[model samples]
Target: MADPVAAVAALDEPNRRKLYDLVARATCPISKDEAAAAVDLPRTTAAFHLDKLVEMGLLTVVHERRTGRSGPGAGRPAKLYRRSDEQIAVSLPDRRYEAASHLVTDALVEAEQTGEPARVILNRRAYEWGADLAGQAAEADASRGPASNRVTEALARFGFEPLAEGGSILLRNCPFHSLAHRHTELVCGMNLCLISGLLDGIEASGVTAHLDPSPGHCCVRISQAPSSRSPSVSR
Candidate 1:
């Protein structure tokens, strides 16, 4: 199948970004005109690229529907375009993640060699510190009414334009789930550990987690700590 990332890269710079954004936001198929408008490209330009996207199999025309008549009794309705699930598969085929991991890893190395007595342990210490904070918050005296707007407040802190849906909040800003792809359980545990310390009752359990590596998107679930009102379980 055509690589979504590669296909996007093949396009011109700004247009590539525009296409990625369009694919990300559009839930269903769009027409050439709508796709053009979605990317803010001129009609002719949009049309040209739309066909290119289709040819690349990065997008497909899903459905066509009527637009309102231009006159009292206009001709046939306008055609609509949409995105297809078959769009390109964007991935980090390069060593970008490895390079980033090394950067953080090297930071740790430098501290030990040059910094003060405890300097070598910076980022690791930070992660631990952050995890401790998460654990505490989990065990805290925090309260949230289930019927209340739970996500609206949680996402505000994360700096995401939060989207709420049926008791769930989606973080739209992260286009990929980078952390989780490496190790599901490990990342989840890290998240839980940090969040727990950040909350009320929970303390650092130092739990070793088993994780599956699914290199796509990782989900970070944000919820209020389990209330004391509920039946308690062993920490």
Candidate 2:
């Protein structure tokens, strides 16, 4: 699991946080001396804090020759630092507003082009996005030893706090709680479809997703597949 807390905590120190902001604001990777001059700190002080940020994964370090020469007189290569490409999200209970935004954005684009209803497009796009996530998860799992119970890990990774309950997995948190509260029918229906697609993408045959709505819980629940059921999601 990505630790948002660690990333956030790393920025608590005032000078370290200032150095991070300076590097992040730069259009390109910056040298420690340049960073020190901007922030009015000694080069050694700047290097110390900048290295700490790199250690925390907030910044990435690379070595490059500042001068356009490669001879002995060109001097030593300078170390450059820049903001890491990794994204940092710090939701207290872990919300997935980005996921909601992606589905809605895709829906709008497809609806505009295909002349389909926005809601319909939203559902289809959401399912596709979920499947893409599952596909990526599968690839990652393949590289890290044999596959185990990835369903629960996948759910948790996507911010749907899954709780194992006998043969079923109950979702404790809905990443789209605020949106779902306002538009329960639409959001819940979309959730069901997305999870269904995820299950199919992961190729888990014995388990299935169902629409088991309860207050303060996700609308979808995963359980052992029934002998017979409709191809579509149930309410």
* Model 1 lDDT tens row, 1-235: 4655667665666775576458657776566677677678888887776666666666665443365447666665555445546634444432234333543466557667777433223324334544454444334426643323333443333233445544334443322246545654433444333233322223312211112222232244333333412111111
lDDT of each: 0.45, 0.82
The TM-score measured for candidate 2 stands at 0.80
Stretches of candidate 2 exceeding 4 Å from the true structure: 25-29, 37-42, 62-77, 84-86, 143-148, 227-235
lDDT of 2 at 175: 87
Model 2: lDDT of residue 40:
92
Which model scores highest in TM-score? 2
lDDT measured at residue 123 in model 2 versus the true structure, 0 to 100: 76
User: On a 0 to 100 scale, what is the lDDT of residue 159 in model 2?
Assistant: 81
- Which candidate tops lDDT? 2
- In order, what is each prediction's RMSD in angstroms? 15.6, 3.6
Q: Which portions of model 1 miss their true places by more than 4 Å?
A: 3-5, 67-78, 90-235
